[model samples]
Target: MDFEKIQNEIGGFSRYQVVVITTVAWLAFSAGFGTQSAVFISAIPKYRCAVPPIDDPDVYPSLGESDIKNYTIPYDTATAEYDSCNRYDYNLSSCQGDGDLSCVTFDEDPGTIPCDQGYHYDQTYYKETTRTQWDLVCER
Candidate 1:
């Protein structure tokens, strides 16, 4: 119960030593927790869509030239030449050529055509299986 006796028994450490020990302890704690935090943050987005903001034009580029002209000519009975072509497909060639083409279909899966011209689709396919697993974990 004597405070002075307890203090004497504990002995004294140098101020520099105390400071170094405290700093080392803090660094070790941060290293452990910091790594864990980083991993968890990275894993969260991988398990979900979490779509990022579209700011740059280069982020979602244009489609092929021949594909655009053939598909977007405005015909009553339109036929898709490419196997990947569909009604909702966006003509990426025009966008790249003039940078003024604003036509895009929300429903269609983006398609890519191979040509010398700058025409390509920005397709993003996300599997639902991984998301389902995350959902199960969240439920638990």
Candidate 2:
């Protein structure tokens, strides 16, 4: 009922008010960071199609990481990067005994296909992330 009396009793903009406001502001700032921290933890790392190792050495020799990318992965000219979701559908028999992967022939138009095996995440930056753990990079 007595607005002026209450205002004087509370003390307008006193040191106590400053301390309370500052504490609440600091807590709000910290809470904001806490809520947004998932962006860093759940970040998507560099990844690619996981090309399974050749089980039968006679069919296709076990290739190194780079060799696998060169032989199986398709280079996207538009993005100027290796395609992450798809790989070139090739004939395993054709690649047999071919030390030169470049020389290996492919289907008339060996179009890119979705990865059948899985995905390979580059763990250099993030050891494990949601995108890598849940395989959320590409469509199911």
Candidate 3:
């Protein structure tokens, strides 16, 4: 009536059987690890609009990327996050002409659209990967 007793009477695992079981277990573990890691490959890293850089050394040294991110990118105060895929369509020459020389966030409007150039993503954890290499953020 006991399956273990019946199997023992029939014969225990042969060396070949043990090898097959070990190989299958290893393969199963590897397959599960690979399946779980698939999402991280396309994982979208935190990103923001990559606006044109200021060539002026005077301005470039004075400003941080965050400053440009604040000025050129739209932020949602309600969510406290910058619009990942959209940027404010502002004329750089005009913005520079204003000479305010300080970051100013504008309200998100119809002008908000997907980044015209591309995006900037954090490369801390990941190197140039599928997501970062392809600029796959926001709508894209």
Alpha carbon lDDT of each predicted model: 0.40, 0.72, 0.68
> Model 3, 33-54: lDDT tens per residue?
7897865567666887766554
Give the clashing pairs for model 1: 62-92, 63-92, 63-93, 63-119
TM-score to native of every candidate shown: 0.25, 0.56, 0.56
Model 1 spans > 4 angstroms off: 1-12, 43-133, 136-140
Per-residue C-alpha lDDT of model 1 across residues 16-105, encoded as one tens digit per residue: 768999999999998999777743443322221111111123543453434444443222345633322222234543443333445544
User: Which pairs in model 3 have colliding backbones?
Assistant: none
Model 2 per-residue lDDT tens digits across residues 1-140 = 68878878888668997899999999999999989889656888887886544323453565656766777889989988988899877654344353545434554668778888788877789888866888888784
User: What is the alpha-carbon lDDT of model 1 when measured against the actual structure?
Assistant: 0.40
Clashes of each: 4, 0, 0
Residue 71 error for model 3, in Å? 0.9
Q: Which stretches of candidate 3 lie over 4 Å from their true place?
A: 1-40, 55-59, 93-110
Better of 1 and 3 by lDDT: 3
Candidate 3 accuracy as lDDT? 0.68
